[model samples]
Target: MSSASRRRPWDVHRLPSAEGSTFLVTGGNAGIGYFTAEQLAATGAHVVLGSRDRAKADTAMASIRSRVPDAHLSHLPLDLADLASLKSVADRLDLDHLDAVVHNAGVALDDPPRRETGDGHELMFGTNHLGHFALTQWLAPLLSAAPAGRVVTVGSFAARSERLDLDDLQSTLDYRPKRTYGRSKLAQMSFGFELDRRLRAINSTVLSVVAHPGGALDSLTPSRPPVSVTTAAERLRALPAALLVQGKDAGARPVVRAVLDPEVRGGQLWGPRVFGLRGTPRCEPVPAHMADAEVAARLWAASGELTGTDPDLGFR
Candidate 1:
């Protein structure tokens, strides 16, 4: 695996031009998502930032523009936590076809009291997993035809050790902040692979790929001005941990590769190469949990039931 990775070639500085493609990135206003948007802008793609905060979206766009003066950009007002508003968000997109969507936006709260979204599901599960699941259903029609479009679901390395509690997916039975967040991402990763399976079963052209930004630290991230600023103190603190992780920008590479790589196939997992923690993007093995068809099918049914509406995947 290490030898093949060293032989596999990819240059982060010279991404192929996407030209006319249009991509919508959830939570594109900050962190890894912001860096992903900024990097994609240089490819000449029409990059749209989706978030509930209009002010932050505006700032993120400006930050990208500061570096790439002619970058095409826009914004979509979206609150994934609110399932009721997704259809309207899709309607407002006003595009005949969308080239790609990076499912990177998520909520990871560390505090004690477990929270819930507007729809009354656990906050992390709702916003991180079910929210994207529901949004994908709404966005299905807008995906490009002929050559097919893509959906890159950004998971986390944290999900590797986590498994969904089939009977209590929302952690209603027990909620530990870190574990709950991990399970939510695990659910999201499961959905991505399962969606690919269903799409292939029906011979659909839409591609679904999964990826995770290993360990990304804000302190290691570069300055994006109004969007983000990495302080010197934070950099000093990160020094002790530099070998094990990377900056948010570096972390976004796997997602970018998943989004734009022409040779990449559906169901592939793209992630950091070295130690699966920090390095350039490379294809990695899909962990056992993510590859479990039986479990994923069950989760799919549960998600379809919980989400309360469906778009045509081959199964249903």
Candidate 2:
């Protein structure tokens, strides 16, 4: 396929019949996650809201129930910053099977300051990448039980500018918060592709897909500069740029499409097509390095050691 004409997963307003399916959406209490959960519930699917804050999860569930009246929804606590909490939440899940998992929780820090999580890794890398890594691994069995399961990891356009700093995965040296965030996002995408390869190799039924919101405007937080504001000129440019950015609803399309579109290929990526930034949902290719077999193998091993969950799951 031509690079520019790659087939998209779905257009706006196209959704699958989710009647017997169950979904788990992290950070589902607000923003794009909330809308995605609401839409799924509207289609008669049972949704489990995964949020760090219990109160927020309650509020989200109440809002959705108020709208759908019969929306099947529940809440679970998940604090990505703490591995112990991740494990606890995983153990408490009642579902024996999961149709899809959307890893939507993320943090965008302002600067390159060194911040550590409960697990002792850089905050962004730990929460954005490692946390999801552990959660997905724990949920692998449930996902594998489904006839056509999907694991959707949310990534970002910033990943294009990131290079895997294996030498300093934790950003222990020359740490820049933005770069670290980009690297973490790259890790999320890389993990999705790597998981797809593992599933294919083992002939497993699970499918893995990665997606980014492009430049979606966040509703839960105030608008902020992208990453770097080296000068007043850059700040000036952000003013109009934010205005032109796509809405969170449009941004959530890729995630929704990735999970619902039957044509979505394992290891495929979905995002906006306009300027490769913000627009409707479409399928796109990730950088070749993101799917490199050798790098993926190394990353899988490293992640297993760091997160205490194996990607291969003994299915070599």
Candidate number of the best lDDT: 1
lDDT of 1 at 180: 98
Give lDDT tens digits, candidate 1, residues 1-316.
Answer: 6776765467899999899999999999999899899999999999999999999999999889999999999999989899889878668988888889899999998986999998999999999999899888888877634266888999999999998899999889898999999999999999999999988877778889999999999899887787778888889899877799999999999999999888789999999999899999999999898899999989989988888866453222
Q: lDDT score of model 2? A: 0.80
Candidate 1 regions exceeding 4 Å error are 1-8, 144-146, 311-316
Among the numbered candidates, top TM-score falls to: 1
Give Cα distance to truth, residue 205, candidate 2, Å.
0.3
Model 2: per-residue Cα lDDT at residue 299: 74
RMSD of 1: 3.1
Candidate 1 residue pairs that clash? none
TM-score between model 2 and native:
0.86
Model 2 C-alpha lDDT per residue in residues 78-195, reported as the tens digit of each score = 8888987766664688777889999998887977568999788889888988898888877887888888999999998888988897878888987888888899999889989998
